[model samples]
Target: MAIQKQEFIERMKRLQASVRLSELEAFLVTAQDSIFYLTGVTYSPLERPFFILVRPDTGVVLLAPTLDRDHLASAPNVDEVRAYWDYPSPPGLGWSDGLLELVAGIRLLGVEPSLTQEIAQVISAWQPQAVPLIERLRLVKSADEVAMLRQAASYADLGMQKIIQAAYYGVSEIEIFSQGRAVQIQIIKETEFDPLNTSVLTAAWPARLGTQPHGVPSIADRLKDGPHIGLSFLRANGYAAECERTFFVTSPSQNMSEMFTLMLEARNRAFALIRPGVPCAEIDRAANGFLRQEGLGDYLLHRTGHGFGLGNHEGPWVAEGSPDVLEENMLISVEPGLYIPGLGGFRHSDTVLVTSDGYESLTRYPTEIEALTLLARRSMTRLRGALVRKAVGVA
Candidate 1:
């Protein structure tokens, strides 16, 4: 809801510059992320379609739903705002009708890659290449974007504090998530992170039954064992930061603790390699390579991390063979995790800011195994036992 005109001006200036250099008559955006980056207003891309047309000669032309007129009014640097009626063709106009009006005189136009095939059919003659200009521009964060990321990272860290408290023995995954989510909502509200924009809260954990990366959090899945971890993906004001921690209900089994230490070491190794000029792939190798060397490579689920901003998962991916190069002020998550079916997952993710000299960790939670260990609270539900072989405590 809070719109910054200066940010919008700066983005438009950069986009215009890119347009001039590329000889594009105009740049068009259809994806929510691309439109949000340029217009400072993000809408849910559900039934209704939205479009932002950026012309070098003209300012910005927005084709959006009439209901969002007030919201788009707050947007900075936007010139022409045309609100189409509801979807499914309302007699005279629809999304394609709006597009046809905009590109009537334009010779060449470049559009966001995410624009649907049906929408592209309206302007296919222009031959849009899904230009990398906007994506590349988004890779480097402005001062304000970095500031928002820090706030989002702090929000994630705040949630982890409560999640650790809630992950006691006999605590249901759902119970832990609910308590932690409540506290995090307050934190997000306090930070003034816009909930209407991107996913502004948290997707927390102790929600899973085992080591798999993807699992639904259920009340039936209770923590009774060695490692109870929570992964928090917190979005503050449309920008997101990833933070996660591994905690033990009781003392971790020797293997769990040792593997956790190794995971931390891997994360640290990736941290040390971050700088302005390094290739993104090297960061992945620094972390994943270590895990592979330790014989835990088979347990790896995802990349070392990826870029985060307006898009929850953006460009400059930190994965092996990635084509992106690290730059100052670009934020990435270096989460090096290892998971085994019966033992549960051990991954520590942090929002790392690629600084001028090196990297600064935005998510500053204690990683010490002892600090993460929690004592059992009163049982919330009667979970038979853990999917994990042994709970350090009685289930």
Candidate 2:
């Protein structure tokens, strides 16, 4: 389920209080995610600018494009919604006119750091301060947000399971990803989930391509007898979670097996350090330090993990040089990877919630090497995938 209206009301109230504390006559929120958090409203502004003006005493006002008026009718906690005719309207009917009218007498204004340069210049008269008030507030998840994240993580786990089952000899990566997406679609239909707010992305990086952590997948590429990275990154009901695993279609070489073990150990080390009041960097150091001691530090590519919420990747980054401290109710991923050039990549990611004591993993997919290694099974999926690829002329 999506967050209740009461939660959104409380969020707006908190933002107002923060604006008052900052001694700003008004604060402008330009980011879509921040707007959604303050008021239970979601819409893509495209080229049109959208703004939420939070005043210390005047309450919350939404300045949006006319196209979004009816769509945002049910949004809670918004005192007023003023609409502009369109993006490139005439002098008196444009977004700038409406914004200027709203903040005519405001002497002190604070705007979200995400405000575009165009908007910054338009509001330069106010000398707007770029404050991350809403971003900081989103670092910690509320009980409802945690529940949605847990539900999203469960879907991710299911997507991983489907990907593993669909991985067969000669089956293409797209075929395996398709099977995972099919299952998620079925769930969305069955539960009547909000289609716009939910998303499912399954990907496979096989053999050499796995070495490039962000490499794009090819439809022609087939899974082979080596280490493969399977990813299930999804969001359900406005909350996001990720589940990833490294699996082998057939038995792996000795070196591959050892590397997988080491990668898992690195992830566990990070997991052990997850608790309230812990520095995010410390968790990363624990895992990276262990890998460095084992002489595989050069293979470490990215941070241990990152936060998750309304957006796929948010604050409280688990990496060196991060200034964030772990707090209770923060949702984060614990993924430590080793990307060896010829051997392929070894990494596993799970969405975990930081609790008062330690942490709780929401994605409960099996991670054991034995569980990950799959035997070639005869299936029609291979034949079907090849025929579709040929028919579509996708080489």
Best by lDDT: 2
lDDT by residue for model 2 (1-395), tens: 66888998888888888999999989999887888777777677789988888998886788888989877767788888899989899879999999998888899999998889999988899999999999888999999889888888988898898888778776686676576667577667655486666788888889878679899888778888789999999877678998999999889999999999999999888988899999999999999889999999889889999999988898989999999999999999998999998889999999999999999999999999999988857567567777756765765
Give the Å shift of residue 67 in candidate 2: 2.4
**TM-score per candidate:** 0.89, 0.96
Please list all clashing residue pairs in model 1, or write none if there are none: 225-391
Which regions of candidate 1 are displaced past 4 Å? 1-3, 198-209, 376-395
Q: Which candidate tops TM-score?
A: 2
Give the C-alpha lDDT of model 2. 0.86
Q: In model 2, what lDDT does residue 284 have?
A: 93
Off by over 4 Å in 2: 190-192, 387-391
RMSD in order of candidates: 4.6, 1.6
After the best TM-score superposition of candidate 1, give how far the Cα of residue 340 lies from its true spot, in angstroms.
1.5
User: Ten consecutive residues with minimal summed lDDT in candidate 2?
Assistant: 183-192
